[model samples]
Target: MTQTTILPIDALFSRVEAIFLKAGLNAVQAGALARVIVAGERDACKSHGIYRIEGALRTVKAGKVKPDAVPVLDRNEGSAIVKVNAGGGFANPAFELGVPELAARARKLGIAALVINDCTHFSALWPEVEAVTNEGLAGLVMCPSYATVAPTGGNKPLLGTNPFAFGWPRKDTSPYVFDFATSVAARGEIELHRRAGKQLPEGWAIDADGNPTTDPEAALAGAMLPFGGHKGSAIGTMIELLAGIMIGDLTSPEVLDYLGTTTLAPFHGELIIAMSPEAFAKGRPGDPFARAEVLFEAIVGAGARLPSQRRFAARKKSEAEGVSLTAAEIEQLDRLLDKGLDAIA
Candidate 1:
């Protein structure tokens, strides 16, 4: 059953922070992560939102993810390279710091590279890209997870459907944000479909023998196919190299057995690059912002919507009318929140 409940965004953040804190996260840590998570949900990214909170809590309880890990930055002077020692593994907070630091370094050297080791999963790269955009730079992000995808002609899950995000700033229009996982579909979407008892979409995944399957269960046990076949596979491979191999993470076949599971150092890798827009728009640039606006208006005006627009619009509606929840999810939350008389914590 569907149910309606109204929560101001601020209230939602507070509630999430309180819950995380009670779950053993330190106040600062809980608050920081809550901001990241709530923003994802608010932007209609349920896959990276509060839905992840339960998994994070489980990981913390299982001692795989630390609730309060501070990031340690490792940079090479004048080298445009850095490393982040993210304490406590994936789903921890340290990885967030590493992304921007790398972008900044990339800006200084026309190309920068950084690796996040043993850090927590940083939800939705868009939010992180927004950070780079604010710095007036063009940004590219490659974030990899445990292996959950197969190679072009093989099976048994040899790589992650690692997503790639690129952001280019405009003088007038909103930044051009391109964010998509390498797979035909993100695993989280499949996970959600499975949780909702729905079948997988066509061409989304392959069975253990490398044949396509619409059964979510089989897909889970199988491998996700690349988005554009070999092209996507090629891109996925590049992401794995930048995000995994460059960082000394599980590479190639090693990821096959462990992809999609939390036990592995899911923090694996993320590489970011930021370029000064001034480099490209140096001369005779008719207000890049104005140019972008005209292009965006022409496309969206002509029935072509930008990729993230749908979610952004849904979030706006949700914010105005409040988050809509199924009766079951609400009941589950209530039960979790009502555990014992000391639940207020």
Candidate 2:
């Protein structure tokens, strides 16, 4: 068996934060980033975990993202739409700055949307979705990435891997949450497969010649297929329309053009819609939360697993026994802290 080292979640977080600080990221940017990245690791989502640090550092080194940007919140009083301008920084801090107001507006208005603009996003959408659920509301989150996915019936890369996430609050237990890339897999997964010298599963992607391929490098050079063919393609287009075009931010194609490469984090916008279940169910016959629990129990009773169950299990284990990292991963973290951006390339 390969040897691994276990570190407390807080210890790992400090190391990650230190690396970002060394790379010149401001406190807000670094702290928020560390929280999400560490949470990814703690939940066993390796694709978005510490593996993402290098890409973020690369983005910083390229000057494509502002390391010291302070996100500004525009309350837009009496309106259901709240906005946070990231000033070209990482998206995590912007979402953090806007969430409380989003929750407040959602409670007051029954539904509210938070629009995050001018941000470099490289993390999973589940964290943001969970944040809203923690506020006792249901939430939907989505964002466009660099163009890397092909629309159905097309071989060229036109749409982003584009993630979508949803969360519903559950009392006395973890929230009901699901987060997934509209593509067959997230772009980060392909990168991780390449690093591990592993072949991707069939149907994930095609080569530059538009032929099916399992080679990670070839897939990276070509395009990833949408998850459910036309269905996923439609959802991806909707995300681009709602989160990109409607929010007045960069679309996947525009992002790819502006950056001219996919090596850096994609600069785009995010859309988060929060709805108070209590408010929505106020005049209805049943309690929404309790009703949801019944539905959840029935599904599980039929042996159908809920999404994120494995993630939550891993989170519980990590909290109890600490996070386990391969020796190479630990070494990489040490190198990052010591060399900062110089360690990335």
Candidate 3:
């Protein structure tokens, strides 16, 4: 077995932030990026963890993302829509900037939407959804990625492996949350499989000729399949319409066209909707939180596990102990910190 090293969560965050700062990201961008990345590692979500660092650095090195851009928030008063322009920076900081206002607006209006535009988004959406839940609101987050997944009946890459996430606040314990790629698996998973010299599960992707492929290299060069065929295809299209076109941002195809290569993080927008459960449940039959808990108890009673339960368990373990990384991962972090953008290419 490979040896591993455990580092405290704060220690890992400091290292990640240092890497981004060395790559020229501003304090806001670097700090926010570090928090989400560390959270992913803490929760055992390896696809969004340290493995993503090099791609972010590569984007910065190629000038595809602005390392020093500070996100600007627009309150858009009296409207249900709040806007944050990422100013060509990473989406994490922009989401951080707008979330407070989003929570406040949702409480005041019963529902509100935060529209983040012109951001290079590469992280998982659960962190953002959990952020909303932290503010005692339910949240739904979605974003379009590089054109990577093929539509149900299509042979070419069109729809992205668009990710969607939802979260509900809980009075005790971790919030209820679920985050997943609309594709059979996230593109990051395939990349990880490639790095480990592992073949993908059979239904995950197709080759350039649209034939099923288990090879990661061929899948990367071709197209990923949607999760539930037509159902997933429709939802992916809906994300493109709502998060992309409706928000006046680039669609998946447009993102692929602009990026020219999927090697870098895709430049796009994100949609985050926040809703106040209490406000929605006002003057209703019973307490919404109470009812939700009862439903959760029933699900568990039936021997069904809740979404994100394992993740929360991992997070608890990481908090008490520390994040564990293999020797190679540690070396990679050291190299990234020492070489900055040059470590990628």
Candidate 4:
């Protein structure tokens, strides 16, 4: 594989969008997904960055994701929600559909909760949370997936490394955005480490026998451990109840049905909560956005950077210079592009 410099962010985004467009996505949807990718990179979430392209395209080629499935919303008294049959399309649009509605709902209800179903792989929830934050609202999102995790002490993998993300509006500071998997690390990160033939950090994953293992390959074959041990396990269990049981879109069952085997796919069940500051602030801080700026400054000065700050900085640098690419990764991208071209041919 020949090494080549990473494409500039704009160039990278365009190239990424082209791949999706080739799979039949509309321009708007492509743009939305690109935004998600760029944001993930910017926020230093490399696992969700360009590495996801090939896997996503594979799902598209398998007819698991429809390239043109737009989400439709259901409005009712006091609350509004949407059922996205992304028809096997990308997850971003399905989640993006909630953005405007969540903001509107916050205006009316003071708080709004959105549930997403049949959505494809939604990447980092940070960007979406940040979106609501930018709009002067507090937003929290959680997504549960199928079993790739062994419950705290169990040998059987019975839960997904469910993720919960939150964005809170702060007066005079960047919104406090927290996004993380219930697992010690996300499955995608494990996958990336495996691809790189690297070992995992301590206490992250366990082998099939439920003993900790540093080998990424073993972890992949086995299961990941939850964070904060039992406490985090409880949170993941709660997310499963919220995203799976409540929504009637169980991730494990769906994985079995779709994959024809019990192999897991990181399908997600997501919830987004948007709360307006008008209820709490009582109109004193008229501009919630301005309040956010102040809080951001204060927090940074206090030696606390926003969640994903490192990633955001990296992304900014990358956009100005170029996206980082190892020779191996570039080769992989070329191979993926070739496969995509072959699909059309």
Candidate 5:
């Protein structure tokens, strides 16, 4: 029975907000994060949306994430390089504060970087990257997380399932954005398989013994493998350094230690860079968008779709007809709703 529930996007927002509120978020805070979650669903980013909501609430209850946290701008507040300390809160609003500021600085200075530390990221990176590109600037954002995936050729997990996001804008089409996890299989995709009692495909993950396994539960209990083997692992390592050593944020080992003590959201860090072509490239007559559109046409004419075409296609269809969710998901939400709001915490 293909029982799919189709609802307006706002309905999803309201449901997510209600759940966040029940999990101890104020209206403003809940609204801020709710938007991130909703945008994930809107873009068909299943892993970063509903799949991780419960974990976010659990972290809040565990005191790993502070609901009322406010990020403090560091001493280098108003320069080309920007930094914000989240004091161990959600990274959604932190990026909300940093993206626009970074875009502004990049517009004026040609390029700018923003580093946010001591924050927990619970959503997709496209929103932040897209935000910068919307301002007519190129954007690249890298976020390092806890050690869930192992480095290539290593038994134990050494690095986070880091996300690398980049965006380029176009004049006649949607922005070109690519946001992906370095793991062979995304964390949420693994979770979905586990929930459905299905095994993961080959190359996704391995058992605790270092041998690869198709068992989703065992893989989750052990570690995820890097996509493309060492190449992906190397990129993950680079992202860790860029978002950690480069900016001096809490690294993966520290996050693993923090997780050992509590089930809360692990404090993490993010690196965001924005560049304006008006300042860097041919300034007067060179239109970056126009140049990119030519390549886009070439690629499409060659019968190849771009990186984000599927997501853009999905978003268009969803906007017109609405989005669908499995009955199991709705049932889970209903069960959570049935539990008294105060009791959820």
Candidate 6:
């Protein structure tokens, strides 16, 4: 078995940015992608970290991603509602361009909604939501993808994993955040399992024939299941309609069924809503943050683990001991960097 290699966070970020810069990304885009990667790594989200680089590169080469994309603010509805046209590229820089404007509007209006279309979501959503919360606001982020999961009680795959994320600021610690797929597992997670030659948990996926399987290879070639049977399917539906359709973009099934498969991540669009707790509550005693503090006290008093608590712990460890990566994964990255444009786009 290959050993894992650990490196300082700074080193990792520098190397990842260099690789992206070689792959048609501008300095700003490279830094944005690098930050997203570091966030996933320090938070122990391996599936969304360096593991996703090759897949991202493939799409860039395929012309599905405009590495030089300049996402534009299409419309501003009042002080709280906005729209972004992402120029059909990665969502990271688009959010970078749009978030500050939307956040400014939110701080003024006490709430804001930014609907984005024509952007591909390749990383975890929590990072974006966390960004909003870190800037002193509550947030929600969600996106739709190609049809790769079956709804409850049906054999055929009818929906995508449909990721949803939420974030809230905290008084004494890091922000509380959670990001999850409505499907039993994310495609990236399944890919990780497959790469490691590991079996999957029960109810995670089905074979091409629509039969349940614990084999990661079969699961990838087939379909992932909804997480909580009908309940998860329902939430997946809401995300598909809200982030996909309501955002004036094609839903997961629509993208696959009509436009057909494009590349690695055909995720069409995303939705982000930010709200200022102070704006709503005026932040008096026992107000929004204080009330939330009371709730947090009760939760921890009951010995409950808060959302992203593990991630926070992992981040602390990474800061002290450096980030770790498998030797094989390191080799892949090194080779990509060495080959340059020929290997990237």
Which of the numbered candidates is closest to the native, going by highest lDDT?
A: 2
lDDT of 6 by residue, 86-193 (tens): 788778887888898878888899888888888877788889998898888999998888888988766767788888899999877788898888898877788889
For each candidate, the alpha-carbon lDDT, in order, equals 0.71, 0.95, 0.94, 0.71, 0.80, 0.83
Which pairs in model 2 have colliding backbones?
A: none
Ranking by lDDT: 2, 3, 6, 5, 4, 1
Report the Cα lDDT for candidate 2.
0.95
**Candidate 5, residue 189: how far the Cα is off, in Å:** 3.4
Residue-pair clashes per candidate: 8, 0, 0, 20, 0, 0
Q: After TM-score superposition, what is the CA distance of residue 309 in candidate 3 from its true location, in Å?
A: 1.2
Task: Write down the TM-score for model 3.
Answer: 0.94
lDDT of 6 at 288: 84
Once model 4 is optimally superposed onto the true structure by TM-score, how far is the C-alpha of residue 336 displaced, in angstroms? 5.2
Model 5 lDDT tens row, 153-218: 888787888889999876656798898889887777888899999989999898898888999989
Tell me the lDDT of model 4 at 313: 67
Which candidate's TM-score is highest? 3
Please write out the lDDT profile of model 1 over residues 67-145, one tens digit for every residue.
Answer: 7666677876767777777665543355455666766775666566666676556567787666677677778888677
Once superposed on the true structure, which residue ranges of model 6 sit more than 4 Å away at CA?
A: 1-6, 75-79, 188-202, 206-222, 257-263, 283-285, 325-330
Structure candidate 6, residue pairs in collision: none
Task: Candidate 1: list runs displaced more than 4 Å.
Answer: 1-3, 89-92, 99-111, 171-173, 188-202, 252-265, 283-285, 317-345
Candidate 3 weakest ten by summed lDDT: 336-345
Q: Residues 164-230, candidate 4, lDDT per residue (tens digit)? A: 8888766544557788889898776888898998889998888988888999988987888889998
Model 3 deviation from native, Cα RMSD in Å: 1.9
Query: Candidate 3 on 269-341: residue-level lDDT in tens?
Result: 9999999999999999999999999999999999999999989999999999999999999999999999888
Quality of model 4 by C-alpha lDDT: 0.71
Cα error of candidate 2 at position 302, Å: 0.8
1-345: candidate 2 lDDT, tens digit per residue: 999999999999999999999999999999999999999999998977999899899999999999999999999997999999999999999999999999999999999999999999968899999999999999999999889998887878999989999999999999999998899987878998999999999999989888899999999999999998899999999999999999999999999999999888899999999999999998889989999999999999999999999999999999999999999999999999999888877
